[model samples]
Target: MFITSENATPVFKDLTLVMPAVAVGNVGQLAVDLLISTFNLPRVGYLHTDCLIPMAGNNPYATGKDDAGELHTAAEVYTAPELKLAVLQIRAPVVKSKSRRFRQLLLSWIKASGFSRTLVLSSSHAYQRDDQQLQGTPLRYLVTPSLLKTSGDAFKELGWREMEKRAPLCPERLDTGAEEERLYVPGGGITKGLYMDSCTEDVPLAVLLVFCSEGDNVPDAMALVSHLDDWLHLLDNPNREGKWKIPTSWNLLFGSGIPPAIF
Candidate 1:
């Protein structure tokens, strides 16, 4: 259920919704954090559901101790009305058994809200790339037919790479020769399933993803968001990396310094 922070539900019709996939390195989540901080978007509502683990904390985007005490939940929606953009920042991982339910919940909300399009920021394991994946840019994308109908020439103009489908290895059927290729995005939690589901549901959705590993992914987040800006034009001259603001919550991303006593 979506509960508004204000008394009235905000109108989201035709707004671009950007969300993250809890995948490898948490890159998508990190990128979303950047988007929220950069835009200084305000909290619109909460996507409260049991499909994700319950977690709560002080404001992750707080600038000081005074403002840090505000309560923030596992999943929240932020909005920048001027830009006609809405962002869903999910801080918790999905409950493995309820993954499908979570996806359904999201689709239902998107439909109800009447969003023009939805874009997911996600990442896959770079090391798992097949021979075909290793030859080009680490960034890739996937678009549902509904999005393609309206997004004609946009992706093509950007020179974006579509995620490659890999043929499964089946030695037993080597004589027959397997011709079917499958979308395999290892470490991309719910990304593949959600994308396929959106296709079937006729949802206008796009996924912008990167091939990355599980380690300091700040750079990966920056790169992903920058690419997204190219199409969305979230800010004037947003192509510059230095222009993006880093959130105060990211200060201790790796935790505190080592204790001198250990020496």
Candidate 2:
């Protein structure tokens, strides 16, 4: 269930919710880290459920040494009240059997909270891309029908490319028109599921993702965030190439130091 902090303030209505799908290269999560750290958004609450593997760690967005050790849960919510933005950062993968339950819970909370819209950052395996998909930029976007009317112009202005629906895998299914073109997100964990759910529910949802392989994906994350900034104007700078501050938590991403024995 979704739970708020004891001192959490009421600020859910009409907010734009952003989250990341744990996909190939973890580009989405890293982009979220950049956003939370750069904006210094506060941790407002967390979602407690059996659907996800339980996890806890030091606050990744801690501003200084005093709060460096603050405990953070697997899925935490942070917000920027002024911008009407809320970000849900999930650090752990969902339990395979409970994936559906988790999606239901998330969608229910979003509906109950009355968010204006939702955006998901995700990534897919680069090797799976078609020849046409590999021709240009690796970034692509998808928007539910409910959100198309509102953000369509902005997307066009930014010269963004919408993800193309792929043909079915089975050759026989194509003859009967039983195979409609559908968004296929290979390696995108819960992204396709969540998006399909949103489409069915008529929720205003948009997905921004990149195609990448498994490796150091900090650059891919940066590019994804930069693409978002271009459309949303999330940062203060007018220049599209403005630099974002990296979070302090990244210092320990690979671990704090070498083991004493090894040293």
Candidate 3:
């Protein structure tokens, strides 16, 4: 099941961006909304979408008819000339039957608008653990920091927000803070990791920053958004060591237009 809705657009300086909540989770939309709201940037567009699928291994939505009768909703388009950035949210349940169709729709919009690069905000678990391997080994978190960098008239700030916060969640230790620790477990213990079940603002910011900067150096990109996440993870935890290879400076190339200050 997939769904979409609309939110009001904003106004940011000369740059008006369209933020879309494509799937259920609106992290992408939330990130852009925060950026625009915080910086008072222009917003050209806002769209929201969602999805639903049979998870009990049986299509209860299906009647006595087509078992393959999956819900593939229609695609939507948000257009604007001043559109500098677009945020897309992909959730657990998309109209698999319409995945290709929706992808085509999104691609068509990007191509028609002459966007340099599409800043894809992919969910962390989607890359590491699909439906087939949901309860398998813990995923190794990684990212291409190279696709992030920007400065000058318009800049990109990249990073993830602390989605899961420490709260009085457990009833067993309602009054005892000693027994309750800030654990990163989303679903029991299998899906445990800093970003295993959560999406970060950094994902979108990194991609957008890169596209905005015309592919600048990765370190410079890291410098922009790296601090956004800060040191949320502590040592001795599985998150203390992720397999994401931080791109070296040699692996990145800066455009001549990039400021010397960034170097």
lDDT winner among the candidates? Answer: 1
Q: In model 1, what are the clashing residue pairs, if there are any?
A: none
The digit string of per-residue lDDT tens for model 1 on 1-263 reads 89999988899998999999999999999999999998788999999899999999989889788989999999999998778999999999999999999999999999999999999999999999999899978999999999999896999999999999988766356664577787999999999999999999999999999999988999999999999998998867444454688998898899988999999
Q: Where's the lowest-lDDT run of ten residues in candidate 1? A: 234-243
Q: Tell me the deviation in Å of residue 142 in model 3.
A: 9.5
lDDT of each: 0.93, 0.89, 0.30
Q: Which number leads on TM-score?
A: 1
Better of 1 and 3 by lDDT: 1
Give the TM-score comparing model 1 with the true structure, all chains together: 0.95
Candidate 2 least-lDDT 10 residues: 236-245
Give lDDT tens digits, candidate 2, residues 1-263: 77888575557899999999988998999999998988878888888998989898887877789998999999989998887899999999999998888888999998998999999999999999987798799999999999998988888888989898887777565766746776799999999999999999999999999999998889999999988888778886453245688998888766788789986
TM-score of 3: 0.30
Residue 62 lDDT in candidate 3: 31
With candidate 2 superimposed using the best TM-score fit, by how many Å does residue 4's alpha carbon deviate from the native?
1.1
For all predictions, the C-alpha RMSD in Å is 2.2, 2.4, 22.0
Query: Which regions in candidate 2 have their CA more than 4 angstroms from the true location?
Result: 173-180, 237-242, 256-263
Once superposed on the true structure, which residue ranges of model 1 sit more than 4 Å away at CA?
A: 171-177, 237-242
Q: What is the C-alpha RMSD, rounded to one decimal, of candidate 1?
A: 2.2
lDDT of 3 by residue, 46-104 (tens): 22333223232222123335642433222222333333433332223446565544444
